[model samples]
Target: MSKLSIKPLADRVVVEPAAAEEKTAFGIIIPDTAKEKPQKGIIVAVGNGKKDEPLTVQVGDTVLYGKYSGTEIAIEGKDYLIMRESDIFAVL
Candidate 1:
């Protein structure tokens, strides 16, 4: 696939969320209704710093974020999250 054309502004960032697990370790198949939202993702795009506050995260960084932190979006049928750099909790 071609590179994403979306460009975040300010301290915003674009993240591609990790896929949710469909099965448990005990071999139990989890239904879609029981699946949890992934709190982790890879940075796909980053925005420039806001004034003197430069963003610490960069593209390709695997990060953990709050469950309800970012706004969900779809690009070419793929899911992504757009949120501020502060929304990300840590880089894994």
Candidate 2:
């Protein structure tokens, strides 16, 4: 992966979202209009925790989050999401 130029502040994290699924479990092709928003992503950047609390997730960690958790952004023509650490659920 290329180095990112953006940094998040205070407990916020920047994520690279997984691409939307293009096929169903049964091998059926899904149209773009029917593809659901991805709820999983990889942590690419992290912020220092507030004072005493340390961040549990780190760069390169794959995690799950709310379907609508973060704000979408484009960095160097690539898409990403920036959200608070709380929005992330579990590390996979």
Candidate 3:
């Protein structure tokens, strides 16, 4: 697991989004403007859940989320998403 300098405060998590697809099934290369946002990512950091509900997700877990789920942020020259745990839809 990576040791990040930033930590989430509540049910928020930091996710490293998977790279956007470079090509289609038919071997067509996708242009930057045509490439879609990735919805799956690996969790890098997480916050403790609310007092009563501890978070089920943990660092290093690969997860699926909505297309427009989290807020985009940059740390240490890398892109990451910070969103509430509720933004995550499922573990992969």
Candidate 4:
């Protein structure tokens, strides 16, 4: 699928979440209810920083965020998150 065309606004960022783990190291399959929420993702779009506060992240940067930070969105059947730059904890 093609990338999302939407652009974020000030202090906001768009992220494509990592896939949920499907199996354990021991070869046990994880049911959907047992899967953990992904906390890391690739930045797809970033807003121009807030006045006097330039954003530290850029597109394509992989980052870690809060468990329930961003709003979930679906673009062209692909899921993504949109959150404030402050919501991102670190770049990986």
Top lDDT hit = 3
Cα lDDT of model 3 by residue, 1-92, tens digit: 45899989889999998776665443434344654533778899999888998899999998878778889999989999999999998886
- Ranking of all candidate structures by their TM-score, best first: 2, 3, 1, 4
Candidate 1 residue-wise lDDT, 3-41, digit = tens? 789999999999998766565333434244554533777
Deviation (Å) of 89 in candidate 3: 0.6
lDDT values, one for every candidate: 0.82, 0.82, 0.83, 0.81
Pairs with steric clashes in candidate 2: none
Clashes of each: 0, 0, 0, 0
Model 2 off-target regions past 4 Å?
Answer: 22-38
**Candidate 1 CA-lDDT value:** 0.82
Backbone clash pairs in model 2 (N, Cα, C under 3 Å; residues 3+ apart or in different chains), count: 0
- Candidate 4 pairs with clashing backbones: none
Residue-pair clashes, model 1? 0
Question: What's model 3's overall lDDT?
Answer: 0.83
Superior by TM-score: candidate 2 or candidate 4: 2
Give candidate 4 misplaced runs (Cα > 4 Å): 1-3, 22-38
Give the per-residue lDDT of model 2 (tens digit) for 43-79.
9999998888889999999787877898999998899
- The CA lDDT at 28 in model 1 is 38
